[model samples]
Target: MIISAPSASEVRMSVNKSLSSRIAFIVSLLIVSVAWSGAWAAGWSPAAPMLGPRSLHSATRLANGNVLVAGGFYITTVWNFPTAAEQYNPSTNTWTSAGTLLRGRRAHTATLLQDGRVLVTGGESTTSTLAQAELYNPATNSWTEVAPMISPRAFHTAVRLQNGKVLVAGGAPVNSATNAAELYDPATNTWTAVPSMSSARKQHSAALLGDGRVLVAGGYSATTPFWSSAEVYNPATNSWSSVGSMSTARVLFPLVVLPSGKVLAVGGNSGAGLPPSVDAFDPATNTWAPVAPMGIGRYVHTATVLANGQVLAAGAYGRDSAELYAPATNTWTSAGVMSSTRGEHTATLLANGKVLVTGGSGGSGHLATADLYSPDVGSDLGSALGSGLVQADTCAATNDSTPACSAGSTAPDRSFTWTAPSSGTFTVSTTGSSFDTVLSLFDANTGAALGCNDDVSASTFQSSVAVTLTAGRQLRIVVDGYRTRCGTLTLNIQ
Candidate 1:
């Protein structure tokens, strides 16, 4: 069932049923206020670097579970762009060079087609922006050129639509920018002009939302020097509408469509250089708000959403550092550093639950070294109480010396008693809007973490945290370190 939007009653019901356990958790307030202190404060180790080292490139996933990385400048030349291509096999954790492009290029866009091929569009060679387009067939491992675009352009926005057509929008044709837009039909291998944007832009970012609309935000405008203005494109109506402007004016930024159906605009350069700014836009309200900021300023970077609903914003033209964003808390955390400092590289999420980052300019020049980011199983929530569990007066009348559960302590947590469902192979679970907390199942006879292990790769925020418990017996439930004081959590058994 497609739910375009749900009413307020639906939202409240979800909150109540979902957070029943958390509401029962009685603790203090110290833990809730200190939750955000962990943002980018910790760094995870990267999996491994890819084979080659080429920067200013693009990478796309194939239907067959492999990734295609192609074209970028190499070495430190005035612009020694290479047409070389490579394919990565996630199953084997290896990379094999594939067919190269007919022409060397950089800063191009690659759109994955429905028929299992990828359409490579315009980019700059050593001299000028390209109008040409090409197609790559994974079956034969080759590239074939199609008809050129009506206008020569590079750094333009290209999107694959529901009808199997690709829409190419505004960018520079010469040294100057243009508002022109075009459509490409793979069925005919031809290009046709669509409605031009209200403003001309380049180095902007575009994202397709769940409701079949594309939100285009931030880039340089020909009229203004640079822009923070944003707009939405309705492919069904073939029209554009001004949405909202960003908190800061930036170009060469990255846009990610979150699981919640909201759009997040990450770091970018402020015309003269890069800036450390992160903002989110809600299409439902047509507004933007500041979220967490990145640790470092970045432009020409890549922001990729993982299967687990976390976003990995990695690689930028100037820096090698990367960060992960958790929508559950609207915060950013450092996810470890890359093998090399890269800018203009491509980060592609593989089907095997790993992200493949390939090719970009590593300070020295264009590079080909690739890296993979694998998410950890997550750790236990420990003994810390998370933010936002209903803190009722556990000792309203009798206990006045200590902070009551209702008033909450600087750090508060919820305690609950559970009768084990059965004896064999039982586990605890939760459904709430908090952290990825650690769940521990204890013997009613014993009050220790499961197996006496403190780190269980799961952290509780608002949802239920469960560990396997001995069946037929009683167990204790405790949630540590919630994401927010305002967030809710529910505990249960499964």
Candidate 2:
């Protein structure tokens, strides 16, 4: 729900309230001086398992809010490929048969198309890498074979571009990796060759930047066993360019786009073993910086962006433990243990804010078990104010503003949490900002609107909001732009 920010007049009146009530405000603060824990009691819980045990599978959340799990290997005396697919209904927490694939495959990529259908791309079959692709129509609950890619690949990365075309990049065709890339146009149901990546990589990671460019980073190939190099694919120019390389070479990891538009590369294997290190990429500056590493070293694990903007990295090779990464604090917190150990799993964020983790290899073998994760929204909001940047235009999708103050902000925003030190009037301002700023406040616990301000006066582009808050009361302050203006800003709370 969108909450309107208070006007300048309202803010002025609040700050100028009679001093006669100062004693009462102090008393209220003392009465509630206890600190708030803001801990999340809900963590991981078992969900309905898949119809059968499998690993190296693909799980895609459909438009209908159901997860579709397709083709993977079921271990027995030998590796057995499963052609049957299943759909998970979050409403009922049950799994139902979706359909069957034209061929049994694993290590493939399943992409959700703009038309609400899922496109399953090339992967390894029982014998060799398969270039054949197929589309699953949720409305009809069936699969239809589409045009094959220009190259056969397994463990490749397929990212849906902003223009509705799917970009399929490097993967191993047989025993060696290839630099080949292609694009799938859903409108014409055809595949076209695109410029290949500078590096031949498989089991690498790729994410779409806010500016519509795809960033592909670190993987292994026959020539180069490990790669720390990174590059970007620009569809407008139909070209590839090198960007900053990661400090550590990684493979089989995941690149997640944060709310701030920065791409985060989670833990992955560095040839030696799993590395706990993590890195964040800034597209605006084309640089990579080290961030807080996870407590557990993991590779082939799944990192999912929670609804509250925190990242949850769960399971690894023979590990069932999970942890949460808070972008606001640059810290990691334990997310609790899962029911079973897994790697090569798929974690998909549900529409209702819960995360669904599906099949992967377990301690015994391939697993059919599934788990759900509920995030701690309150904990992610209580970070201390500091210097920040407004990156991606995520406010529109989140409806974080209203007509009162931030009606049409195409610019990005950053959020912080501040707790009242004592009872009385306090001022929250963006005095040393680089651009025109819009500041708004919300109750951290309940997410209720508190106050907001666009500017302090006619001559100033900075914003300030003054309100009386009780001691230990945490508030979420958002630093947004006037419209499309965004840059570096410092948040001051006094």
Q: Which candidate gets the maximum lDDT versus the true structure?
A: 2
Query: 119, model 2: CA deviation in Å?
Result: 0.4
In the order shown, what is each candidate's alpha-carbon RMSD?
15.1, 14.9
Worst 10 residues of 2 by lDDT: 383-392
lDDT of 1 by residue, 182-272 (tens): 9899999999988888788888888887887778888786678788989887888988889979989988888998889988889898876
Can you write out model 2's per-residue Cα lDDT over 1-494, one digit (the tens) per residue? 12233345434544322233333333433442332211122688788889998899999999988999999898799889999999998766789999899999999999999999999998999998999999999998999999988889999999999999999999977769988889999999889998888889998999999999999999999998989889999999999999979979999999999999999999999998888999999999999999999997999899999877899999988999999999999999999999999998899998656789999998988999998886644434342332221122234333344424767765677776778766888788876555567889888899888888876764555788888888889888787776665655555656
lDDT of each: 0.67, 0.82
* Local lDDT at 79 for model 1: 52
Residue runs of model 1 more than 4 Å from their true location after superposition: 1-52, 379-494
